[model samples]
Target: MGRNTRKRRTPPAAKAIAAAAALALGGGGLLWANFHASAHEPDQRAWGGNQTKAATAQVATVSCPDVGQRLTNVPDAARQGVARELAALDRQITEAYARLAATRDAQAKDPGFVRNAIVGPLGEKRAATIDRIRIVVQRAGGSFDNALEQLAPCATRSANQTNAGGGQQNGDGQQNGGQQNGGQQDNGGRQGGGIGGQAGNGPVAADFVDITKVAPNVQGKPRRTANASTGTFTTRCGVNANKNHNTDNVIVAPGVTNGAHHLHDYVGNQKVDAFANNQTLLQGGTSCRNGGDLSSYYWPVVRVQDGTRDFDQNADGGGKEGNVGRILTPVQAEIKYVGSPAAKVVAMPRFLRIITGDAKTTTNGLANANAHWSCTGFENKVQLTERYPICPQGSKVVRSFAFQSCWDGRNTDSANHRTHVAFADPASGVCPNGFKAIPQLTMRLVYAVPPPVIRNGQVMNAYAVDGFPEQLHKPATDHDDFISVTRNGLANQIANCLNRGQNCA
Candidate 1:
């Protein structure tokens, strides 16, 4: 699965190697941004002539040994070693940032600055650090398993932010504790910021940024199947009581109790869910965190109406009847995950199946006209945003919101969990805009790593996003969607840098 299996022109393995190289060599240019340096410039230190105020908040240092301790409990000694190595790598990243900041400060005061003097030493230091980390990972006995999981959350602080309760450094390069050497050396000998000797100058290296928490994205749609007969399934209420008498019968035979009614099309990718243990709430008691479902929670689907109007009691229920009372066009579902008792009960395993047709029933003043419409197409898809929760024994926890619509017409009424033709609507054609659906199912099982471990000084907790792509889904479907990645923005930026690496600072 890890072999090169891409297009004739470019192998997947090659592209992966190139990406890793770009990041490591600083060819990606992302690191330059952290130092407020331009990608086109020659040396990052050249810009450090103007020193900004040093951040004052001191970070509570999390050392490599601390992370190593966590790894000790894991049965796999090799995995533990990888964790320790990753922790050391994180430490190197932090030091690189510090070195860059120091180098830049030194050059700001001295007009005669050498670029190699600054960049060379930092690169060497970084290389040594990287080698040490690699050695540790190499010693780890088992295959690299969940190494990203342990490494993702180890946060590194930025040099720009104020240090916690420490002495100050300002934009003018003034050191509070020392004599100024034409703004060169403060008595402290700290090199930059009016401190003593000048350290080599270079742009501050970029630190790791946690990207776990983001604006909730649209998961997928759910609706009735195209083949299901409009009148075959019976509604919970009879036809006479329906506001749209003709349309109300969308739910028909077998009654709503154990009817053929099925929820349609909704789905949340379970591959991204992190693993967890439901038995305990203590930190490290379970692997699930964030929204991963260790506890019982309900995500309620609610209607958000923009305007109000009376029902079309008089219409015959066709073109005009369907337009009566302004029923929502079903843009998206709004789900509430926590603090809703009604929602929680409704989400239970059996109960969830019972109320599949819980849409509001309308009455038309006739016994046959009354019926409850199937809410299958109306509900929005919900996802456990955090790592997959550790469920208690016999606890009902949902890993994915498998909408009935996805399997409505297919033989997969049960959770076959097989990859199928996604995004094949004839109306929109194949491959939606800005997306290229790869027919091959590159299944990457992502582990959730929480923060302030991944990013330093973050006010909100974050999660580390790491996973490996799995095998392909063969004999691709006609409706296959273009596989899109929301987290590739950074990668794109890296690509931009590699294509123009020579001129980059």
Candidate 2:
């Protein structure tokens, strides 16, 4: 059960495709623009003028390199310091973005204003932080170079540059869906759309799609082998009606306050925060009906943009971070661990951490995106990733996560916190070589949300998942987190129940 004994391997494809990309870091979410590069739009310096300058060429968000994702090899000795510095880098971007918003008038007056005033200064700050990270990484016998400084230059994402999620806005101020890149809402904003629910980031008219308009998007199930593990086990965790909410991310930015910059609704283990560790969590209380299942389960809060406010409205991760509106408590939060179609699942190591979906997917691209959005009655239809589905009056909204079910059978975690676990092959249900199938944690969150109105081509009473300010509350940024703390051989019981084809709750 010791985590350190597990040998880890980063799949070759994981490396070949994951070059640094750009991300938008803004308000309450400790959204680390930790410097990611973007293949879609490289660092953009707002240039050129247009008749609809305010709504078109305006600098929309701050784009920084994803430096944190690149540091997958940081030594344990240097990891804590590196994480703090990376979080620092994220905050720096947030501050710069605030400055960018504050100086919109100045930006309008001079095309060079944002470059001179905001982006330039942010790059300097990031270079300093990146240097500190390099020092710790190198001191710990890890290889790091000044070349990472190349990622320090943050850029401005003009409105046009940011609207690539779907087709362009037409006369009706709506966007046509795109099959190549997922569709998104644009709302073809009015001039000075900089301030909305918070910072006017998005949930634009284009972001919402009528469920009836979408074609069926369900894919065939993966093929199962004769020897596959054929059972499932369920754990009943209440739908977080207890309102255990926070903006801290204990896994990604442990010990760093307000690391997520967005509020998260937590169920299962009660003692998770920016500082939670294995010891503290093991001793923590759980909300699950089963006493032995003390796993931590959480996802960003879903907020209805109805001009309402909550306790954190003035606080960091709440309204201050652009995640405003009334928080929706799901009527149901279903948690299940099911056997892999390929083989029997093994027990998860105690304290194993897993994250599904990408919180910064709006800016980070669809590479790691795993959002599944649908409506109650339309569940068999296509699930959306970028666009929020506007269910009919009788239908409700559903957000779900199918977490990686394959484990490396060694370490409980990795430097980036992802490689230790992975999803099986989409077609074959087989784990990658050297990996073992583990019970997949499939969660479904059902909410009784009122459909947003699309009157006059504008989306009203919108709903969105809390995310980094720059991510604009796009549905693609939806994610879920978990930390297994099974006690008294509960994990073995889970595996046994699953392999034997029993549904033990």
Candidate 3:
């Protein structure tokens, strides 16, 4: 197959790096929208200026079809095996992307370098991995879809968005921060002055925007009917101040190490990792104030692009994978379970897993992009999906997630990880016909980050969610995950509290 062009149609923020990670991460479709920035003229501060245009404009990232989305069903027996193969695909993209980022110099000199070296070899790896997934399903007596093979080939995305005379810049006018004066400056933990940062990956200036400039984006809330479950159950989970962090994902890639390819700050259950199963999680200690709620809540840690390093700076899932800088611990982590406005709520089944946002939204379209990004003071005024909010000095950055509340009432998990649960209709507040409405878990995380500044094109002190190297650290890739391990008694208590319109903690 030949290269296919994908033009970004989203806002000015950078596009995605990998679609594969959404398997355990998040969901959305893939459509490259060509968002060309033709305004920024030549700037001497940038490298090589017009001399570097051709190579930079033609190639930006590796875009492959999301193979995991093709599987509508997989036998429960083969789900784990299939998940492993899918994760293999995700790893392939990451390795290829890291290489592409490292070879920027060579790519500039040879236009064919990325295609012939990175994308070509990556497709071969994906093909082999896809084949293994097919075998896993077939062995479990599940029908193998031929369409899976079509996802094997991924193309290099072009970057027509680069600023003119901005050799190392991001989109027009907006610059990427890394090493500034044609040399890499070791900014303690972050490399100053380039968009490619210390690891040659993201959180570019293109990813941030002044919060006040954004229009009001709060969606209309559903009307509360008389049948609405009006009560709430709040659980106090320490903000992972205990530093429970890992790169594993138990729900999607059980038993696989480094499954998330990014470090996650964990709260509630203390023993949730790639190898932990339902039994271990149930036995695990929790950080929640309510001992009855042993549920686990986790999300990728956000990092500030400063000149310092964390312990994992040189490790595979850390700086080596383009996730650098000091991790930001949320000052506030609030967890609440509320009743649906459409109907009285039921107890959530134990071991239910739910993901709230698409970590691959930059590559995955906005269909399932539910990241609620804003500042503490302006949260009700705006909600961002594609750009990181540049909060005012007094306001802190905020990341909020409202987990899906409608359940199929049978399976606690699904092959795609999303089909088992769904969000209530935003307008009507109703579950799909056969699905039951369960108590919805909502989380709000607040972080105090230095305001990043973009001057003459370069960005400073940028912050971003840690994600797959290929996902490029775009705010659009922000997301969260959860697993309910609440005891039956506590689960019933939540339901009763909500049904009675009482708030309990």
Candidate 4:
């Protein structure tokens, strides 16, 4: 009676309302709820702010999150204002060096003149000094390629102008405007007229190699962090519960394991027979799985010290400890006083580098992928115990800016260039012993990216990353290894991933 009494006669409006309610009930509230949730929740742009702010925030929020994100382009409203200013500064620095060098060379002929010129640009010869300055100025002018590329979407295009031919001019020091010079001078002791040498160029001619000069056109910029955990599996080495923990006993046996007793893969035939009992566990034997039983699974443990503390698992009863050994995040490792750079950048001082790393293969045919991901004896953790690869002689610092380049082994064209656009954590780290930790910093390099070029009807751009370690180019067998820090191993992974699909990110 209570329910049906009012339904004696449905008004036309009431009947329509009932029909709509029936339709909605048939579908349930899922569609409406979803729509409502989506509408209520902020849109991506609203949540993330904007693209430019988002990138800068990624780096700044993590370590130096509060830092400002200056547009890669020069902030000047005037035409080529930033470029002109950069070129001029470059010329000044270059002329300073050239004048000093020329005076030093002319000492025998005119010691008095040389001495006076050292203080200030002296007479007629000031032209060459000025020319050298011009070269630097030009290089500086063209070095805004990264900034320009970043600003392209917002840039107003003119019919007569093009983005091509903006790189540092060879020999002439005057970039883009078409002055002539021998070739761009690199800081590797090779003379050149440019505002600033590449950040990752090693310190000397002996360390130089034909490195790729352009940045790649993959991602706009690099993401600071990834989900990838930096640890790999290693079998227990010989016991060294003493002062000097040498890892000659630890060999790549035949099994892979996480911190737990679970085994994932085999370690292969590469055996480390240096210890008393030489045995390789294959296919997850009971002992290999349950290493808690030392008689079954005895992994030699070593204590690596970080700062004042030791990387001790403190496993009172040890076979293998979980991932509890205080691994340093990339942020922590690179945020300290690495060291002062021998050079400066953008009027600011930078720290020196200690160890550098890259993706190139060693004599062992072990690339970064194998070193970090393979089940064989090749691994970053193991290789570090064997040797500490630092900067070669003549390199201003052990580490340099990590550049971005093409994944194709040796194919670098204008379209694809490397970039040093990442200002994430100012610090970089290396595997000192069996684990990756931050090494003490010594110096830093300041590099500028050249503007892009137009060839065959396509416009191209270039950028730079750090840690070139050009010393690897030396013919000596010792020169063939990649630097072990600054995520060179990661670089190889990046190279490998890009080779697979250029989606390594």
Candidate 5:
């Protein structure tokens, strides 16, 4: 399974298409901006204005050190040891931040409580853990400063304090506060009316163009196609048995606690968080039906909130959406894997993370275009609503997710964890040239949402996922994240079986 043993092929046409698409979409420029933008940008705006504009202190470039690289030159035993210690440190860092966020949320109204009771203690603990991480990196012969720079800043010195002043405001007041604080407002701060916004009242026309429809029709037949001889292997990961409500697993968006604004259901790996590295993930147990495959899968917690309840009732600040009430668990989770017949699929590098859907979307209509909501039998009839769908008596509600399967052969992750990978052409189901095709992973989630109750002239649905809480839980907020932790044996099996076209379970 060494890197040099794998054969490399160049699909010049596909590479050209991918490059053209990247340029046309301005992906390179956007990637640069996202990388340079502050991880605490949203939180800073949430608090009010930038407090560092006049400060002379240089901001550190925060990133995740590639633990994979550090293991290369080391002996096998020593490599394992490094991974184990790093995993342990990752957990410690995440727990420290979680404790801080919980305390901050609980005592949000009291600046003194946050500063003394929350920030000070947690900041010290985080700093210590970070120091330990640096030592671990140095022991592995990597630069400590480089490792530190990959991390999100643990301290926030300029968070706004007035919202915690014991005053509860309506959604409009919250929106206005965001505007006055120099935060960008979409659609005059209407509930869910900005980027990633859900539809209001009724379904609106699709606002975003589907990329597959516009991508150039690269002429030429695919070298391989899935047929009777070519097989597919599927792994049934069990239902989301764990809820990850903290922001610790999102390494790229460090220092962002509850940044998702909603909870997520987790499956496969038992121990995963913002700080988890490949070693921790490999050592963890799984909730998957197969048990052996330890890949991580997660998505937003979908709830069916009634008119009386809301998810953001306990939320701080003003841009709150609707009532999200008690969170509901999904009935089941289905994860499957398949590969192309023309090429031997390559193993995914450790900690290869992928995300779909826009977490920042508001009511701008098209933000959640990737998010699809539908009733069980009528999966084709998708809708864009802020409210949960009221399926027919016998129907089930479901959320479907498809992930990108092509890799650039080098990096497990990028600044965005996206640019390094691209989706196969929808028409040809063939990955572009230069990228290796891996197992295509797809997830189907079913939630328990009861029929809607008619109140006044409005059709009110029960429970919903927590978003801004001012807007309805629209499909725009539907998103998922995955990190491959499949053991090397199984990964090779996928490659061997798929290339030979043998079906596997």
Candidate 6:
């Protein structure tokens, strides 16, 4: 797929790297490095500093590392060493940008503070970190520049400085920040009073935003209609009634602890976690209705909060919220495979994992395009807002996700957990020309939320998904991860059923 032309505000991988680096290196080390650098330089531009003209712009080309090939071919010992060094560099880069943001935030209180205390030092430290990372990559027999490129969140060249007014002009000549618009940093930096800053930027009430009513046609396309004629098979993964407080099992970003941020409702396999291997998952007990089927289906725990309460009040020891408190289990979980009736689905590669939904919704509006939210019994009434929906008295709130179903004939995963497989065409809903058709895995989670209460003529729902307390629970935040742990028998069952156009419930 062609990369999106717009620059991402903050890359998810970068944030994860920064967070993991912070946890590994004590905050004191980061503070000392920034402080020392800032004390020496008084005038150079900050990292990603504003620039006035495109003519004067200097383009920096960072090459993307062949991460997929590197991981597949490198010796275990060498890979481990590279990973450690990369983590250290990630910490330094994160701290540099953080210090830069702090200085920028202080501009209103103290004039010239950003230039004297932050700009030069931040740029120096960031450059040093990039250089160190390059050396590490070279030592591991990989391209140093490629490592830097991989760390960058966007495809565009990094802007050296912002315009005089603090707004940076993009290739199209649009100013991204400054006084005209709020002086929000475009690169995922803190936006004053924006959703990126805190979770409670909106009203505290547990009310549905009624996205269908508010922006009825915000989503240009009609909601995807179900194709009943398509062959399908389902795995009965029982509901996880008990609260799963396990913060370690998430496979989204390996090596990062509690990467999910919010609590997860686990089903299928009981032992799937960050460190789980195929062998471990195969041997692990399952929560599925069928004992032989051991696939893992997990997603963020949804909670019903009263209008006056917040979901993160009982956060875990790491100060990460949504791990504790009275968690609500889905009424049931529907895990199924759907595919073209004419095609045969080959057995899915073992331990294949897939993720859907945009984790960084605040800055990326297009990220939520694939996210689907609707009320049961009123399936056509789809809403794209991330908050809990106001279902009718007898209806249930639903969160549904459809995973890509076309495989490249080999490779279980790509660097981004996608790309190894691609989504079928929207019009035909069939695998593209070279890729083989696989059973499209879809998950539908039903939440029995309370009916809305009228508050000032607005219908308020009773709860929301347990997301970062600082971020308002929006539909853009809706994400799901799936890891296939099925042994050959179950995988074959899906293939056989789908090819025969048999519906296996």
**lDDT for each of the candidates?**
0.21, 0.70, 0.70, 0.20, 0.44, 0.48
Tell me how candidate 4 scores on lDDT: 0.20
Tell me how far the alpha carbon of residue 15 in candidate 2 is from the true structure, in angstroms, after superposition: 25
Q: What would you estimate as the lDDT of candidate 5?
A: 0.44
Per-candidate TM-score against the hidden true structure? 0.24, 0.85, 0.83, 0.19, 0.53, 0.64
**What does candidate 2's lDDT look like per residue over 1-505, in tens digits?**
0111113222322211221232221111212111212234222222101111123233344456667766667788888888899889878866665565455456666766665666666666676788788888888888885556556665554443445335322212233344332322322333333222323555565667899999898998787888788888999989998899889988889899999888999999998998889899988899999999899999999988765666776678776656777789999999999998888889888989999998765545556779999999888867998788999888889998999999999988777788889889999999999999998999999998989887664567778888877676778789999999989899999998888888788
Using lDDT as the measure, the top candidate is 2
TM-score of 2: 0.85
Let me know the TM-score candidate 1 reaches against the reference structure: 0.24
User: Cα lDDT of model 1 overall?
Assistant: 0.21
Residue 194 lDDT (model 4): 15
Q: lDDT tens digits, residues 1-505, model 4?
A: 1122223434333432332333211110000000011123222211111111000000000000000012132222321333333223222322333333223224334534322443222111222322332344345553322221111011111111211112211111123222222332222222332111121111123122212321221223222233222222222312221222212211111121111111111111122222312233121222112232121111122111111222323321111111111121111001111211111111111111111122212111111111111111122122211111221233211112232111222211111011111122223321212222221211112111222232332212211111102111111111101111111143234223322322212
| Sort order, lDDT high to low | 2, 3, 6, 5, 1, 4
lDDT of 3 by residue, 35-108 (tens): 12123423211211111111122335456666666676999999999989988877777766656644555666
> What's the CA error at residue 308 for candidate 1, in Å?
44
After the best TM-score superposition of candidate 1, give how far the Cα of residue 167 lies from its true spot, in angstroms.
35
The superposed Cα distance between candidate 3 and the true structure at residue 172, in angstroms, equals 21
TM-score of 6: 0.64
lDDT of 4 at 290: 22
Question: Mind giving the per-residue lDDT tens digits that candidate 5 earns over 325-386?
Answer: 44667787777666754555776666677776543233222322356556676565444322
Instruction: Give the best candidate by TM-score.
Output: 2
